[model samples]
Target chain A: MTAAAPPLLTVEHLTMRFGGLVAINDLSFTARQRQITAIIGPNGAGKTTVFNCLTGFYKPSVGRLTLTPPNNGGCFLLERMEGFRIAKDAGVARTFQNIRLFAGMSVLENLVVAQHNRLMRASAYSVAGLLGLNRYTRAERQAVELARYWLDRIELTGQADWAAGNLPYGSQRRLEIARAMCTEPCLLCLDEPAAGLNPRESAQLNELLLDIRGQHGIGLLLIEHDMSVVMQISDHVVVLDHGAPIAEGTPDMVSNDPAVIRAYLGAAEGEALPPDVAGGLPTAPPC
Target chain B: MLKDALAAAVVAALLALPLLGFRLADSQQGLSLDYRFAWVGYAAAAVFIGRLGMAFAAAAFSRVFQRKRQTLLPLAGRPSRNRKIVGWLLVAAALLLPLAPFADRNLIDKATLLLIYVMLGWGLNIVVGLAGLLDLGYVAFYAVGAYSYALLSQTFGLSFWLCLPFAGALAACFGILLGFPVLRLRGDYLAIVTLGFGEIVRVVLLNWESLTNGPNGISGIQRPSFFGLPFLAAAPGRTTFHEFFGLPFSPGQRIIFLYYVILVLALATNLFTLRIRRLPIGRAWEALREDETACRSLGINPTRTKLSAFALGAMFAGFAGSFFATRQGFISPESFTFIESAIILAIVVLGGMGSQIGIVLAAILLVGLPEWFRDLQQYRMLAFGGAMVLIMLWRPRGLLASREPTIRLAADALEAAPQTAGEAAR
Candidate 1:
């Protein structure tokens, strides 16, 4: 991917405090257009807090979060906007760390719900829709088409009619991603998308994320504990420890950085690196 | 199992102690205590035997039923085609009820009452079932509708037909008014606020003597006429309904007319709800019910979605309340109380939330059965309470727990659309 264009989303000096505790401290990063940016950190490093701030779930105690859409539809100061407006007007969609599909609804219904604003307009505030008018029908058919497209992409076409809660864990995760994609976001934020997946499912998720970024040209911001996924698919990586950024660079540069190693291994001087960290980068320079 | 039986015996003894073990009697010699040990022993024995028999019966029943569970419970969860057929059959029966040979004035009255509850159930279903808002004071809307019609018709000498829409609009306004303050609350807190709102409405109706006539209530409320013709034996200047129809003046004719009026009203409520369930607003309600935060993430304004549910639900309840006031020819604070709301809420809950037909079944069971067994007046509520408990134990999810999605994909939608179009053409 080229780096000439301005970044799609920029987070600068973000800080979030809960009472006496600081969850995210002076975090800064950038996610370029059509590129995958992974934020990796040990537990309690405030990676998820950064995501919450960017997505407007939390108003950071201090920060300027900006998003420049490809269409040049004016940058959105996300910190000043409400969460739903950030998703709706700014075209930013996100999935929860824990799967939050409308579990009682069918898989297809979950996807259709993501397109609620479009459908609501097509229905003209439901006046025409209740009458079963042609225009409303056309809009509804288009929505079904878009939903089907995402379902096919997610390989959940066969499970479209099943209640989303009844799906297997991996399938639920994929469906959550598909549901977020149905919103047609410019920036997709995923928190721990591969948390409970097995190795095979995790690899598939990596391919899916890569495919989404490459095909749709949507920016991807991922917070993941799975080192293998973070190292394999990310174009840029940011490492955080104790609520602060420790390293930021391309995957290779950050993986081999000594500061990143010490952050993961708890500052031990001579201990051997964990297998996940060692295996993530097969060829690392001796420290 | 033995321990359970022993516990049951002990519980029975405790229960019997107050009733049988000691009794105080006032006579010429003053108070005297009587011990009824025989009654206590018999109660304990009955409890022990009943407990043992229930255990054995349950074991045997499960052993027999569990073997061929799939075959025996073919319609347990998935009732796609069969459910539709049953629904149509029910509608047909209800429509033909007034014309049935066995129909009598008493039966028609009971059926009308049942239909009113059915309408209320469908209305509350929008808020409680679809939007997952626990409104404990639904009867406030009902009271608003009834009082609106009663006050309008009496004060302005307006006809029932003219006041009906006004009543409904007033109730909807009240719904929105109540909705705003409770928008941020959920679950139990919402329920308590709603309950308080209901009591407030009832209390206002009781205390507002100048407008509501206090506890005396408003009587001689005008009944709904057939168009402009009143259903009277004779009119001085205008022709009565019986005279216009050139039929003998039988009181049953008016009862039958009232039944059809409410029947149409209730069916309209059902049709409107069914149609709205497929619309965007309806989907928004269901989505909000599932997850409010997820709904917001998808750009759905929770306030608007929840308000729509409340207003629409209240509107329908208003329609029913107008019918109620007109039918009874009276309006009072006593009619709309917390117990009324509780019964309506129970119908929705026991009917399985969001299931239209389930509401009808539950209303019939909860309302109709108790009315039918009114001869057992002392034990009526006891039996009703016991039935509710038994139903909860047996089907905790509700009588009709299986849900059918409102939306389908292209493959199913295409198939469904063509068939409906063909039916329309036919």
Candidate 2:
């Protein structure tokens, strides 16, 4: 939470390819702890590919990703972990661009199952103990408590028993996020969390992002197409174009940068954002 | 109402068919009713009544309560102690029917055949239904099991009971072997591989004459006798089952005993499958079926989950296959063919995949109806296939599709549930 603390996630010259296509080319950036970092780009600019690499969905062709901590000592390389292992061992969890909530399952079951890894661990120990092979049901109680805590945090108390697929689209989207959060992630990567939102919903999403960062001290890596959301809520911005990073800076600095503007808003209106929003952006932000 | 009345009338006619030979015949023209046809008729009527009753009950109850009607059915409501009792009663009736005094000999035998197919349908349901993996070579495992029991029992003088477990084990081992190499294939490719695998088993059985007796098949196969007591042969001093009970010996007793054995086996298949569905591995199968990517993200090994589905499905086929050999006292390659697997798959599809009761109803309809229509034998399969297509069109998801999740949290866990857009952002 302090300036002296290292950034939570540091990416250096990450590159990826699909046969002849260079999907992510030399993308480098850092996601600092306790801040919402937005990665925005035109379609096919590899914003999602970068997210995929960070979450172990894709193996980068080149470069390293190191995540530090707000309260811990050393940084760890994220690229080495498998997708599920990354979530388990490194406390990294993510939501998809298209909602991946299990449709036949209930809303509550979706979240509870997110804590499946932990519950399984507990059950194994208890079974062994019952057979006079080992001891301790502490893990079981802890898993239930953790599941309960997140259920309260997400505010989905009323519709818990409803099948996830039956929930309204907006609610399904929220449940997906809450399911990811139930894993108690240190770094949460959300893919286009505000893509289909109305103005009011977008505003609400901004507040949630702030709350998530402030209260949990979790680093947020968000890939978004909504410029309003990216400009309003992101503490740091990394802009990509044609599978490469074009700009990285504080929100205001990146907003005013010609390359960021050209990549996102087109060359003509690159610098046309209202003055107040530009003035609020951080200057010379440390990584 | 008219349809119900007509259906009931048909049921009454079918029930009277077994006694038709005794009562309806006169001492002149010489026409008689077959007992097997009567059994088929009874089974068809049971299916029709059970289905219609469930549908009407569901609609009526839901209308009165203003809730989802589907919940009235078993496995839809919260797990109850009553379900266990109901399950046991159904099992008992299925076993005890053959023991009843008026049950026909040929009728019981036909019913046992129907139960064996039901077991096959249920087993195939695991692979195609639970795991969403299509397998068209299921009967290959049936052949492996049948041949294993026939070869081992005939060559070594092994008891049918002892050979039963060995057959299942051998079939399961082969199943696991099949599972290993083809674990990664999906959709059409997987189906092709399974189809080829089934044909391969049949070809092997046909070519391996020294062991399987080639095209002639292994005959003189032993029928399983209960508690080491053979059914009476009707010669002097041979203890007939009826004589043991101080009654007249009748062919019905032998048919009834085989009926009970198969009925027990079929019920065991159902119970074992239900228990496995509630286990961790079962959930994993469901999860993988829904989304493989999500399953992998949840730390499940897709290879292992898929393999388990294959092995378990094959094991059931083995059980059913060995039972067939014992019941018929004969074996042949022609029985374990691709058409057999297709029929099993059709039953699973028509029945709601993953639904135990649905499969039972579907099996009776698919297998029993045809035999009942044996007088119109050439047209029966055509009608059968048409019925399957119509049923599928009517219920694209299956007859009793799963509308609810198996694992879930209690009602109070939703205190923090996300509401309108305003709350989600914060």
Candidate 3:
């Protein structure tokens, strides 16, 4: 409600369906500014589907998905915008669950391409772009320079010319993030960024996420199953199951929630925990 | 090693024949400064240089320049500040080389023709390679361009230079029109539509007697003059271009001047294409080519991107066509056949899609080799076809295969990545 503390993106009662299937059901959540938020659950728990909705891949069947800009300028109903426009206008960028990169292009080109819409806007100046124009060349040089700047940020200057598809699995994952970062979005949604990463790579990804949040002033909405990554990096955690949020709180809170425990850790694990305050010893943190 | 050397030797010899002892229309002996050989040689040189240069440049660039990749004549790398100055110096030297005392006029002509094909290849490269849209009827635009120039120049007595832009615009309009109807098709279906479009244009040219002068085609089309001087060996009353330049009157002089004109145009095409390729529009083309669905997700209207590709390609073809009419001093539908389209497609495919150097090489091989084998006339096509089949089998991707896929994300994200890096390294 307050101008100073605008939630970056707010989705209220969002539902998406495919014929008889409900992928996301009555889901409501908010990604606050400058925080690492994690959505975690078992497979088919609709963690990715939530990301899809935020990124405008799947339009919600019902309810409003408002992306309130940082300064509370105007809210964007994300469902109203198409995928690319969502990224461009709403400043919402997302990485796929699996690494998706222009493998044929250079690592540098991949990052540069993410900023395509920006360049297109600059070139809209007619004569400057046509007639073998001079003004357009200057703008084009700047785009290349910016692309170079991102490549440096990701520590990928050495492999800038290498095809993106050829990078190591972990490197490709990082490149995807760097690419999403190139668009300079207000909120970055990452889907299973650490899926196949080794411990070191996963740790590296965590550091990147924190850097993205701290230095870039970008909010991260990550869907990660890696407990260490989620627990260590996330400022807030939302636990989902079967297209519904089961628990929403801090990492410690969601980890201890009875419903989260039953759904993720299983019913047997939940039943073993004592209900008495003194006996349970630890209470879950607040949402 | 011996076999490789022999093959290389044969190619070099075949390329040099025009300079050494070939004949052009009998009066000119020692390598005909014809468009066919010029285009062929230009492309061969681009590929030969691109592949070899990649290796050597990669090593030198890494050592001298603290850059990420080795790109000698890179498709994307900006030269260092010092290198930029040096590059311009080299460009100046190249421009002046033809004026050098030692430079052969035939060499100049060949170089000029190479420049023209480069433009055509660069143009075709946009639609077929960058956009991943097959256009089997590109020559139709070439015909449109030639006819536009021919008709306008003849009717209005407009100069070739003045009519060039008009020719390009006319062809571009047709390109966009073709793009709209074919929007619903994909792959082979799209190819079929474009092929049909090309055939329709040719048929119209052949049948439209009132306008196109029917099957005999438009003749006595004026040859472009240098300034106001006509390039003739003997004109009864007036000073020909040769006498105006104070050179001994020779037929070779005219061929040389046309070569330079085409060279300039071709170079312009190359520069234009290079500039465009680095733009966001070029990247968008690559994206659309890779995955139309993802491109839409990115808010790039596929219809627009495709139309741009079609229009840009057609514009260049038109430019080529106008020059073609000027060069031949004639115009006809016979030159705009499906076979011509196929050859151009073959050049793009053989060169490697979206690869400028590769396409040039392919064009040179396809066009020049056939001419070189003219002694074996009937067997020439058989050799060309067999070579194409063999190259496809060996490279499968093409002669100079592209390893980097345009689209990164797809149905199989897992499989596409390794291929990307592996091809670059290879």
Q: Give Cα-based local distance difference scores for all models.
A: 0.87, 0.74, 0.74
Residues B1-426, candidate 1: write the lDDT tens digits.
889999999999999999899989887899999889889999999999989988888787886645643332221123378778988998999989988999999999999999999999999999998899999999999999998999999899999889989999999999999999999999999999999999999999999999999899989989888989989998899989999989999888889999999888988988888988888788889989998878777778788898998999999999899899999998899999899999999999999998899999999999999988999999999999999998997668677766787776656533433322321232
User: Ranking under DockQ, best-scoring first?
Assistant: 1, 2, 3
Whose lDDT is higher: candidate 1's or candidate 3's?
A: 1
TM-score for each candidate, following the candidate numbering? 0.92, 0.77, 0.73
| lDDT tens digits by residue: candidate 2, B1-426 | 447745765766666565542344444568653345655566666657765775677567756644433453322124445545655776777766766776676667778889999999988888888888889999999988888888888899888899888998888888888888788788899899999999999998999888788889998887776666567665365565665677666666777777778777887788777755644456667767767766655555567778888988999889889988887788999999899999899889888878777787788889988876888878887998888877875567667665445544543443344344543333
Better of 1 and 2 by TM-score: 1
**Where does model 1 sit among the CAPRI classes?**
acceptable
Give the candidate number with the greatest TM-score.
1
Candidate 1 interface RMSD after superposing interface residues: 8.4
Which 10-residue span in candidate 1 chain A carries the lowest summed lDDT? Answer: A267-276
lDDT of 2 by residue, A45-66 (tens): 8888888888787888899999
Q: Native contacts retained per candidate?
A: 0.50, 0.22, 0.19
Candidates by TM-score, descending order = 1, 2, 3
Candidate 1's DockQ is 0.43
Model 3 per-residue lDDT tens digits across residues A158-222: 56656666577878888888887878888888888998989988988888899889888878899
